[model samples]
Target: MSAATAAAPRPAPASGRQARRGGHPLAGTYPLLRFALRRDRVRLPVWIGALTLTTVGTLSSFTTQYPDAADRRAAAGTMDSPAGLAMTGPGHYLDDYGHGAMMGHQMLGFVLVMVGLMSVLTVTRHTRTEEETGRAELVRAAAVGRHAQLTAALCAAALANAALGLLLAVGLGASGAEGVTWGGSLLYGAAHTAVGLVFAAVAGITAQVSQFSRGASGMALAAIGAAYALRAAGDVGNATLSWLSPIGWAQRTYVYVDDRWWPLLPALALAAAATAAAYRLSTGRDVGAGLRATRPGRPAASRALTQPLGFAVRLHRGTATGFGAGLLLLGVMYGSILGDAAEMVEDIPELRDALREIGGASVTESFASTVMIVLAVVAAVYVVMAALRPQSEETSGRAEPLLATGLSRTRWAGTHLAVAMAGGTALLALSGLGFGAAGAAATGDGGLFLDLLLAPLAYAPALWVTVGVTAVLFGWLPRATAAAWALPVYAFVVGYLGTVLGFPDWTGDLSPFGYVPRLPAEEMRWTPVVALTALAAALVAFGLAGFRRRDLDTK
Candidate 1:
């Protein structure tokens, strides 16, 4: 090297302004969007494909099941009541009573909730999740612009919504179901995209507000829940309340009935406004930090936080408590409607025919069994999330530090597993009790509550099997841990949708939920429960053994 060249002049170190000279705040957004797409390739397709195929599958079932106008009119009674309106949408769709109107009134609202969830998670994963894992800081250190990450996240969400909307439109239009037009399908799909975009924007703001990724996701989901509640309340009673909710906007589009395109304007407007606000809020905080300040913790740790079990409790307490309360409320809601079960299904011949197949069970008992399937599936979701907590801990690099201090892998993972199992069982029981209590109050059947409570216990073994499957994935194929979710999704499809959508009986055998006897409807059968329990025990044992030998997610 020439001394003269070295001594002559060293290039000036680049200032922050100089480093940012080549691009605007959203520079590199396209590349980041592509990168985000790559990361979510598997997940995105699973979500879209599952939602689309199953939803379109319903059209055939509805067409075949209700072939005539008379049949459709008869089925219309199912959604005519207050409970029906709250669960579905406005009563106007019942006037036309076409399959398209049916999908718009009932299916559209339900699917929007799911679409909103997908959007929320996508935004949070790209923004808050990256920040939590320290990747945002690293990425920002490059030539990447300040707003690039968030813009890219939102773009990715937009892309997903766009794809979903397209698929829905195409699938429904091609199915040639009565009253399902390409134009109406487009409008229906648009409703989903609009709701999704609003929630995606909501997630963006929440991600900026909450320091923890989980907190951000929870906050956004709470917003989705609130919107649904507001819409339901408004639809059932108060005409004004529906106008306040984005979900109401989607429903008010009235696809296949009036096909009112104007209602979607407010949803789109909200999405735009929230997105702008999210961008503005991002400026108030530094990369990897939240706009909302964190409260200081106790100077000393609690004794309970000193052990693996206690630490796990501390980590999972908020989510567990929140979900438990939710399950109980859900159970109560289902129970309240149980006493009116006969009245609810009397005019709907399809339901009456379906119940007749159960032969001896009363309509109310049959109804309770159906409700239990849904409640159990929800409980399974909670358990899966809780069971996957250890993987979250390990991937965050926290597990290694704790393990370094003489903590055995099995003990730590086992503690989390224990929490998952116990929490799942408790959720089902709580929901069952609530269902039973509400049914008893509504129907004047005092014995209902006890029956319901004991009924959920029948599902405990099946939920444990889910936990064990999750454990196996986390233990051996940690990278494939997300696949554990397929179990619950499959269970939901077969257990609930199968019954309603006329999926073949053989399909039920494919899910663990099918093996268990539906509570209160059938006599208690210990053999299946016992067999499931033994399978769970074996799977759990094998998973733990694998975890004991495998390398941790962190060094």
Candidate 2:
């Protein structure tokens, strides 16, 4: 052959077995992608709808809060400050009643975080999780290529993210906010889409490295959290550091104001590189194993390992530690910012008024109370994640073998419930302690520490209600266990935006968090706390009873 002909790309000759094995490396991806989409139909719509609603609701609030030119100008002055920039972003759209930019600043971090979460969970669930549960083995036993599963997962995530982006852009543009252009709104939506795609790629790689789905999720989520913090730190201090985080890249798009699109290029490149790495990594491992080998455990069981509750603790401890440490850091951040409460309130009259309605004694106390409540919501999320552990265990085929032993189904379920309750309560308490300690150190009011410490306990009952709901779902609606996540999401929406959206009192009353007294700002009420706790306990009992009556394997 001539040199030019030899240099041209050509297919390698196939051996008999190879010829019989399959077609192209990505031959089955489209079908698999469709299957994944089918599986995620309900899940994706809920995420997209919730995100869109949040965006529109935020827009509505901005319009109502700063309805005039003068109000927008004053809001812009405070938002441009280093403290404000750190909390939100550069306030690029703070001018012109910058409802679009203000919405971007207030909602971008939260929206991107949720998008990242959805992407990571979706990718990991289809890839490592399916493989771990032996579902992928059956798929692979068919005419599937090695890379098809991961490719399909990435494709599905991209589609979901795209849908979410479109929803955001269209929804916000129609929200009737003055001065909010469709172009900026599109960029706002595009930013989250890019962020989600980048994290989907991150999940692809982490799924290859992690031996279990939970670990893969943790790695991916940890990356997202780090990216968010890096950008926040960079925005506040060195602008250069923001470039290092994907979230920074999204925020740098400056959705409504500057509307730059260049930042998305790096995110796209990152996704491509990570997806390529995942494919390469997938080749060296067996169908179900990870690129990293599973470490050998102790040959003998410890005393703690002898019981179901202890086993539950061992399996869940890593995730709880991760959540607790993160919340502690969050507490520190909230505490450090309390000193700026007075200025912040003065600069933003809407917040000042909202705090007053919530019974804020002073700016500082109001801010603290808000932080505690927000932190409680965060804590409740952990509770839901923890409470849903049993479903994960059951789906992975690990529960059947354990149930085959002396363990009864109810006892096995109860152990996990106990862990969920204990772990959730402990995490909330630690978050409270961390918040209090940091606040006390800052303000030097020793009593402030004690007061703030007790604040989180009041929210525990509400969180327990969330946990109870998860358990009930896992018990009865095992196949639909994923829907349990919506409970927390709904609660968060109601708790965070109910007041701002002019929701009726009964609507807010639907959330347990709404029932809990806004501690330190409003006096504590025993009736709601006791009532919620009793309901939680009753739910747990009902869930255990349901689990006992059902088959061990819902599948």
Best candidate per TM-score, number? 1
What are the per-residue Cα lDDT tens digits for candidate 2 across 441-536? 767778888888888888888888887888788777777777767667766777667655656678767677888888888898999999999999
Please list the C-alpha lDDT of all candidates, in the order they appear: 0.88, 0.82
* Model 2, runs deviating above 4 Å: 1-21, 80-82, 91-97, 347-349, 441-446
Task: Go through the candidates in order and give the clash count of each.
Answer: 0, 0
TM-scores of all predicted structures:
0.95, 0.92
lDDT of 1 by residue, 214-290 (tens): 99999998999899889889989997899999999988888998889999999989999999999999999988889
> What CA RMSD would candidate 1 show?
2.4
Best by lDDT, which number?
Answer: 1
Cα RMSD for candidates in order: 2.4, 6.9
The CA lDDT at 270 in model 2 is 91
Reference-based lDDT, residue 196, model 1: 93
